[model samples]
Target: MAILDYANPTRFLRLTQIVLPWLTAACLAAFAVGLYMTFFVSPEDYQQGQTVKIMYIHVPAAWLCMMTYSIMAISSLGTLVWKHPLADVSAKAAAPIGAAFTLIALITGSLWGRPMWGTYWEWDARMTSVLVLLIMYLGLIALWRTMEDPIRAGKAAAVLTLVGAINLPIIKFSVEWWNTLHQPASVMRMDGPTIDTSMLVPLFVMAGAATLLFFVLHLQAMRNEILRRRVRAMRLKAAAGSRAARMAPPSSPLSSPMSGTPGAAE
Candidate 1:
């Protein structure tokens, strides 16, 4: 019910206005703490040495990349069924952010891989699926930009998002399903994480920071998009009013005191 109600632009804007500052503060604080712990407190990897520090950035960014896509997919579904205005806003705002995180994940993964695996990249299952996910984000963004109509673009993007969602499972299970250079699950396994405590804290902290940052950024983008829609509506209305005024016939007017003639202007 609240979700439907917040589909109203003004309502969403007002809510974000109240929440955004706090979220931004939390993101900054978490990021600072996460970075400090990652560099200072965490032990260097026995095998990869200091290069393993890349995991702090790489793992969190990877999580965010997937989380953002999931958000886009859910928002698209909302747009399709609930017809929520902010759903489209959410999807549009999320695409580029997700892509950026995916890029970070790829770059950092490569850095880590070069040191540990002795190669910059491998056409492994996990790597390939992650690459495909990034491409999907790019495609969604391209579609949105190429289309003229906002509603139509949103619908098209939504469809693309849904289609791309199939890759998420593939990316998730790729390590388990095939032999790969990419490491198997660490934090997610039912038997508990394989990572030691010193490294784990930084990873979790970084994940929290990334999650906070995403919401803060998402809210800001949505607010800007809503304002854009408002401006467009106002411009369209003004244009319609000008056209109507031009189409209207000239009319006789009452005499003004300043003018000593019939049909004088005020």
Candidate 2:
């Protein structure tokens, strides 16, 4: 019941309007502080040297890429199972943002890899699985675009998203599961993060910033989707009204004359 209440487009729009400004401010402030700490405060790694700084951007983008997909998968469940009104919009909105984050992660990883590994890329397990994730995001976006009806598109996309979610665990554990150039998990390990506190703090701040930015972008996208649907409905209604008017039979001039002079004509 509560979910349905919030699913109302009017209520969702009202809530987004109230929250968007604060969300934007928080995202901006977090990025500012995070960037400052990343470049200025964090020290160079003993081995990686200055090149380690790229992790600040690359790691967060990688995290958000998976996070955005997780969000979409959950929203897809809502769309398919619960039939929530905003579920499709949320899933659709997240696809492009996820794809962008995936792209950023890939590019930054390649840049970091070039100097360290002597090459821009390797066909390693981690890299390959992440590439698949990116493809899944693009495919979901394409599915949404190709369908004319939102409901049909939502259901189709939802099924595809859920099916594709098998890649999340693969992406997360690829390094451990297979031999790869990619390092095993450091920050999220059971051994409790080999990274220094100074570097970890900035990394977390940037991750927060990235997450907030995703929310802001997703909200704006859903709002736009709602407006688009409204415009489409109004246009359809107007077209239907025009068609009904065109189909109605016109009154005959002969009928009017016959009524006025019925007795004389008889």
Q: Candidate 1, which ten residues in sequence have the lowest lDDT sum?
A: 183-192
Global lDDT of each candidate = 0.82, 0.83
Candidate 2 lDDT:
0.83
In angstroms, give how far residue 236 of model 2 lies from its true place. Answer: 1.3
* Cα lDDT of model 2 by residue, 116-208, tens digit: 877888655556667888888898999999999887999999999998886567665864466434444422121227888988999999999
TM-score computed on alpha carbons, candidate 1: 0.83
lDDT of 1 by residue, 36-95 (tens): 998889998775689878988988898899899999999999989888778998999999
Clashing pairs in 1: none
Q: Compute the lDDT for candidate 1.
A: 0.82
Model 1 segments beyond 4 Å from truth?
1-7, 170-192, 249-266
